[model samples]
Target: MPSTIRRRVPNALLDGSRPTAPSHIDGSATRRMAIVLVTLLGLTHSNPAVAQIEGFTEPHATIDLAATENGVVASILVKEGETVSKGQLLATLDTDVLETTLEVARAQMHSTGKIDAAQADWRSWQSKLDKLRELRTKGHASQTELERAEADCAIAKARLEMAREDQAISALDYKRIEAQLERRRIRSPIDGIVLKVFKDAGEAILPTSPNVLTLVELDPLRARFSVPTPQAASLRPGSSVLVRFPETGRQAIGAVEFVSPVTDAKSGTVPVAVVLPNEHGKYRSGVRCVLEVPPPAGAGGSTSENSANRATAPQKTDGPPGPNRKDNHV
Candidate 1:
């Protein structure tokens, strides 16, 4: 048997003057609090860091092309802003004289009548020499007669050799004239856009004349920038970076191609270069751009030092200087 269990109830519960909060209400509050805490913790760890660096876009190559031969400009095949391929004729000098000379040389080189005549003469002499040798062996010809025949045969052979030599020289002269003509025809040495045409048709061009045209190579454009020594140290050839052109609103991925070994003592920075592909001529150079590179892992430094790095970082604002080393240009 159980003894009578009695519990005292609150006056409010008995009269139900006001409803108390339910047990489930407390459970709901605890769950909502847990969700809020988890969200706050995630927000703290989910933020990503970004590093901004300054840079500029430049042409892969800039060449001032000059004529190799001196003559009057007969024609200009390309105009400013026109794209051209390597070895494409851009202009031509007067090559009438060279052409005429080449024709004459070709006529001489191909002329075989003289050579045939020489061959006939040589065969005749050889036959005569052989006959003379046979007659001398049979005691029908004197030694002096055989010697005279041999001399004549040798002279004929020399004449034939001279004819061949003349033909070879004529062929060589024709090639020389052709090479000279080619030099007079100014051609683009690289695939690029003509920035300016310095000479036009009917103008005179000289071997020592100033550049005939200014060409800029666009493919594989270069982005040159400077970064703090520490940041630059982490950059290696083949490293990729994001390049953003502020003027054109274009963005591209570029790869590091150069890291200068020398550092600027005053700025404590090093020069760096990245090559960006523009095979389709989609990108133009000489524009201000920014490079976005994430900080290296485990990179920790003073705040002021980092700020200085950002402040003193080199930004490309002008056209890049001409390439110095052979490998520097694309």
Candidate 2:
């Protein structure tokens, strides 16, 4: 059975603890002391823990974008390890030949414009012939003169149609040549630190085999790691991933933007690519990392949790941590 007790004490002493004064210290002293202790206890219990994951300091990646339409490398604007921003012009190919081709095409297009005007003139002549024929039928013009006018109009009309076709062909050629010239300027595919320069100035670059001068798109990049097949089943593309960059003292979240259809037979691991934003530009393409590609968590845990408790269980982080590997995925 439960029991309760109550007693009274002096009004002034009531607010103090330790059985204060004259045996008349009021019971209010005990009450105030109890309230103070409870406030302290609540404050202590309200603090939340900050969670951190162990991961590699630097993200690793490789330099490997192939050449664009090429010619002799005219100039190399950057060296290996130089930083480049997205669309920064890193190298110039000797696009002189392409430039000449484009100029020639433009000239041809201009010539076609003249031919186009001549064709329009021929159509005008044809209209005059039709008017003459109508006038002859009304006896307002001679047959001989009307016949000659018709013949001249037919010839002009034929020449005009031929000129128009030529003009159209020339316009198309000009655009195609212009596109080739534009492709000669090689720009960085992504804002990345230049890790390698495969081409030097004056190197003979070929359209069939391009000479890539600068390789980039590294910073704040893709981290490629593999997950066990069973663990991978729930990971869909574009799913959010928790990312940690230890080197930069950065921690953030990203999305699972890629996963391999092919699985490794020996390791049973499937490749996954995650796109994590690197605003600070601190990550590299090939650095290995330990990625906590998040949940649906505990994906490979015991099957017993699969049925009931797994759906609602809170994360139990006490499990042993895994190795930190550099992610070199480009």
Q: Judging by TM-score against the true structure, name the best candidate.
A: 1
The estimated TM-scores of all candidates read 0.74, 0.56
User: Lowest-lDDT window of 10 residues in candidate 2?
Assistant: 312-321
Question: Candidate 1 residues 169-193, lDDT tens each?
Answer: 9999999998999888888889899
Cα deviation in Å at residue 199, candidate 1? 0.5
In model 2, how large is the Cα lDDT of residue 302?
31
Estimate the Cα RMSD of every predicted model relative to the unseen true structure: 20.5, 17.1
For residues 84-182, write the lDDT of model 2, one tens digit per residue: 777788878777777888888888887856676777888788888989989998999999989899888888877877887887898899998877766
Candidate number of the best lDDT: 1
Task: Report every candidate's CA lDDT.
Answer: 0.66, 0.54
Name the regions of candidate 2 deviating beyond 4 angstroms.
1-65, 68-70, 111-145, 206-209, 226-250, 257-273, 292-330
Cα distance off (Å), candidate 1, residue 183: 0.5
User: Candidate 1 — which pairs collide?
Assistant: none
